[model samples]
Target: MKAVASDSAIVLVVDDSPESLGMLNIALNNAGLMVLVALNGAQALSIIERITPDVVLLDGIMPEMDGFDTCRAIKQKLPNIPVIFMTGLTDSEYVIKGFEVGGVDYVTKPIVPDEVLARIRVHTQNAKLTQSAQAALDYAGQYVFCVSNDGALEWATPHVHELVDSLNGDAPCAWEQIQQLLAPWLAQGDQSQPLELTNFEPPLQAYFAGEHGSNHLLVRLVTPKKTKTAEALQQELPLTKREAQVLYWVSFGKTNWEVAQILDMSPRTVNKHLEQVFKKMGVDNRTAAAAISIRILESDEEAVG
Candidate 1:
């Protein structure tokens, strides 16, 4: 196999031990890979927020936020980035736990430089191939995207913006909305089934895509021939046409300012409509309004079906 270009790939190594970090850093740097080192999981997360690495070398045991927790956090953000665990314990339970927490592969303690490099190469190459395929899909305007268990958009096709806008009434699909929708499933832990939200304008569906770098849930924004019109919602829900429109956007977690821009109204006007929606729905908060709006939309779908 061809070696990756030193400048092409970045690797993050997180370990509490100075010796392990130093050794892995030198080995990876020598293998023509850019290396970033963190003394602990917190430091690793801070660095990851700024830079996306191709692969992560994580120490399984540390004083705080151990390897499993670190890997979980990483998967939440970068669901496609490969994580390899480095641990001294080789018990089956420990290994299983590693995989459970999103480790792609593991390297035993007293690491062999050559073995580590080989494993990194394999995972990194695989990641590149998957990303290349995803890029092709994106260019072809495919709606497939990978979201983390936390509902964070890890990667999506460029065409996704249009679907998101359609779902959110011309507003970009915000992370907060996605996370709110996924909160229920994520709370169920490992038994969480594939989640689907068909309450939007275009109606979206999500399935648990196979775990690769992380446990990524594949979300597909379904585009139907005809979407639920605001008039249809007004008749079913106790809301006026304008209030219904506001509810539609609210369902996708759109803010009053964003709804205002979408509806070509002032922010104050949007707020007034939302307040009316609250009164009509007997909901005090936006979250309740969104939840009620989703149930109404889902019921409408069932009726039509």
Candidate 2:
């Protein structure tokens, strides 16, 4: 094949075989793509950290840091780049292990140059699409991001980067820590509530918008919302902490039973608290009590503003 040059793709091939590297390099270069060769996993990682490729062609088995471990490391740092494994091991276990370590696709050895090229093209196109989408989302000003099912951030906006940096000041692997925090919420899958993560001041709220695709989740960052406390409610109304707790949920239109479920008290206990709250606030029923809470909330908002 003749080497063709054009404004095109870059592929990183990580393998310990001279023959494989030499053959693949010629094929990829001739096809108008730039190929970076890594003798082992460590070199591949070093190359990747310096210049992220459009797609990664990884070998499954190597000495010391294997393909799976290298892929895991690469994914931890930059999850957006697609990883395609070129492996001699065709066992189901090996294939599954590749997927678990974040391999998007695999080409079985003896390595077919045609097959490898085709797979690389497909993944590169998909990766470009994802990058474009991520760039658009960055300018959308909604602080949106996409993460893999396991909570590795595929792409995040500048706003998210700022937030993470601020929260994880001087902390090593802050990105990993943020991922760890989101893991449980992501584990909830589609049925996730807004995760409340607090600092010394207000809290960051992570809302699961939906899934980006079959393999990714979309998360939206809402500005830090100060949690309304039972103590705050107590101050707003001349009521006991328990009464404030009951009234807090009641203000949001919770019934006695629902309030009990939230506050972890019996319905009877919730009713008792509500009765006491009414007496203390000179209110006769739930409506009047709720009205007072609303007025207090409005006043608090006004004060904050």
User: Model 2: per-residue lDDT, tens digit, 128-191?
Assistant: 7876586656546656777877888887766666666676463347667657878987787554
Please report how far candidate 1 places residue 6 from its true position, in Å: 7.0
lDDT of 1 by residue, 180-209 (tens): 876676557653454666666445555444
Model 1: lDDT equals: 0.77
* Model 2 poorest 10 in a row by lDDT: 296-305
The CA lDDT of each predicted structure is: 0.77, 0.79
Tell me each candidate's TM-score: 0.45, 0.46
Clashes of each: 1, 0
Q: Which of the numbered candidates is closest to the native, going by highest lDDT?
A: 2
What's the C-alpha lDDT at position 190 in model 2? Answer: 51
| Clashing residue pairs for model 2 | none
Worst 10 residues of 1 by lDDT: 296-305
Root mean square deviation (Cα) for candidate 2: 16.5
- Which residue ranges in model 1 land beyond 4 Å of their true spot? 1-6, 141-305
